[model samples]
Target: MENAVLLNAIIENAIDGIITIDDRGLVESINPAACSLFGYTPGEVIGKNISFLMPPPDRTHHDEYIQRYQHTGVPHIIGIGREVKGLRKDGSVFPFMLGVSEVTLSGRKIYAGFIHDLSQQKRAEEQLKDYATHLEEIVDERTFSLQESVEALQNAKEEVSLSLEKEKELSQLKSRFVSMASHEFRTPLSAIQLSASLIDKYAQPFKSEHIAKHVGKIKNAVGNLTTILNDFLSLEKLEAGRVEPSFAPFDLVKLSEEITEEMQMVAKQNQHIIYQHTGKESVVTLDQNLLKNCIFNLIANAIKYSGENTFIEFNTEITGNAITIVVKDNGIGIPEKDQKHLFEPFFRAHNTGSIPGTGLGLNIVARYTHLMNGSVDFKSIVNQGTSFTILFKRHE
Candidate 1:
């Protein structure tokens, strides 16, 4: 008697609604929570058919389902919990999680349903989805703004100068183009990257692998576009005579090691950038920014052109009166015919295939080196390997 009273007390005090139905689908018992949930008292619901508490087709077919379960013994909702619609006495519908179990009591089979309300959770999820949509809208707006800016630049490029000298006009135009592109393109690209990261983070809990993959693709494409824009900006600055090498004294070993570590994160599977500095002297007096750009461009090219599991050899040797930086790769090297025009702006190698690049990387590197009193040289054999060396004469 104590155990029966205890079980009844526990069921009545449970937060989740509980209801029991006879095999014929009549409500045999309803706990206080269940009564409160459906806006019905136990006296009104206990002897009534449970279909009155279900919405639409469920209410119409509830008896059929009970009969089918009794005859066939094939369970659908019997042992499984799933989201379902519930109807209240006020003719309103709501969402809930219903877990139904079968119990045999005194040689009679009855079904017990455990219900947990899901209206609040559903509302929260909808709000989260709305926030994500808002983020996407912001990203789209920024992307459209960047497009308009690019169009404006193109229009400016087509206009003829009125009074200024041709060289000066062209220089000013290039400088404006570089400045506009840098600001316009970078802002949207950064938004895209950030939005993609947030979307990936939000989708993680749902185990949305495909969403994560597409987000990764968006980030990678944004990175590539940013890289191409940087190349164009660098080329424009060089053409407009805006870039000048600022020479400084820095540790070459530390710079090279940092670059190697940073670039390794983006390398292909098993691809390694092996960096080494030779000679006792690790200090060099040169344009640190330009030199770093030159090295980064070469290693990036090596990684792009090389296959997985390949090694990119990056070595810096400080010999007497001279410093040499070499990047060697055993990838698809440039064809002999295309070698001469490799450093030309927008000129991709004939053998480059579908690899994405602006073809301005080498040009920028060459110009940067020339500004710093350095020389760029490369030797390539198609399908075998390529090696690029940047030689700088140490200034006293």
Candidate 2:
């Protein structure tokens, strides 16, 4: 009884299911572990067939298997370990690792079986796999979001860079204006002062040849300073949006003619002026000073670029409701590349070799023309000639 009690204790404490089937394939004994594993009691399963513990098609074929084992004595089914399914008392099926061994003792043939449940292990492995997949998804989403943020930052940086470039350009323009005004103004003012002093001292007779020469020098110096001052003041007014036009009836032909004469006198020895007025003598409402400055700059540029004997053609005409003035010079015309930057402040053409200029004349002309609600156009050839046209609204 002590030995039987010890066996019962071990059977009850065993963690693995143990069972035995007789040669007839009927369950002969089952341990408490088996009872717990398949939800069967010793009393209920002892007299029952072992096929009840097998699921599906295998359950129905168990008797044939046992009959074949008895006749042929095959060891394949009697003592083999494999993965198979089991049927519980509750009619549910689950996976298990089954081990079988044949035994013959006490003149009774039997099969001992061991079973290991696989459900819990399968579930744990699946849970870990799901966790890894979820982590990978989270990482991919974060990477995409980070990329979008970087692109946005790069675009913002590019926009900031472009705005900085524009600010730098405007600042450089201001610096150039200051430098040109100081140097260009002082030299002309000094010449005007020197000429006035010499005339004051040597004017014993009003008809002196030296008096004429000094007087001419003083006049030229004053003219240069006046032109420089006009450009600076006009540009300032334009930038401030305060260039209001003083409209009045004025002679446009006379302004053009006088500017042409002045330009011809300033040109080199070989350059001459040919100016004509084709429009009717009609009065126009405009700012006379602003219009005269524009015309003078245009004509002066024409003569400045031409050879000594080259003739500059100045033509004026009325077309529809607009007045057109064209100035053409047969001199060293501007290159195609330099024409694009013609109106930019302080930008001189690359081909302008040692020409004495502040490079602000065309810029001033463009600003004043825009203020007058007019437009200027030009065409140039390298060594042939250049032509400038201005179109203004006609009014009286």
Per-candidate local distance difference test: 0.84, 0.72
Angstrom error of the Cα, residue 51, model 2: value is 99
Name the runs in model 2 displaced over 4 angstroms. Answer: 1-230, 394-396
Give lDDT for model 2: 0.72
User: TM-scores of all models?
Assistant: 0.73, 0.49
lDDT tens digits, residue span 174-234, model 1: 6776787778778877877887888788778866455555566677767777787788788
**Highest TM-score scorer:** 1
Question: Candidate 1: worst 10 consecutive residues by lDDT?
Answer: 154-163
Candidate 2 lDDT over residue span 1-396, tens digit each: 999999878866778888888878888888887898789878989989989998989888888888887898774464446888889999988887888988888986778888878878777656655644553454345435434433443343344434545755654554465466557555755665675566546554434454455455455545555555555556556665677777687777877777877776688886778988786755666678877877788777776677786788999886558888788888788999999999886567887785535466788777777777889889999898888888888654
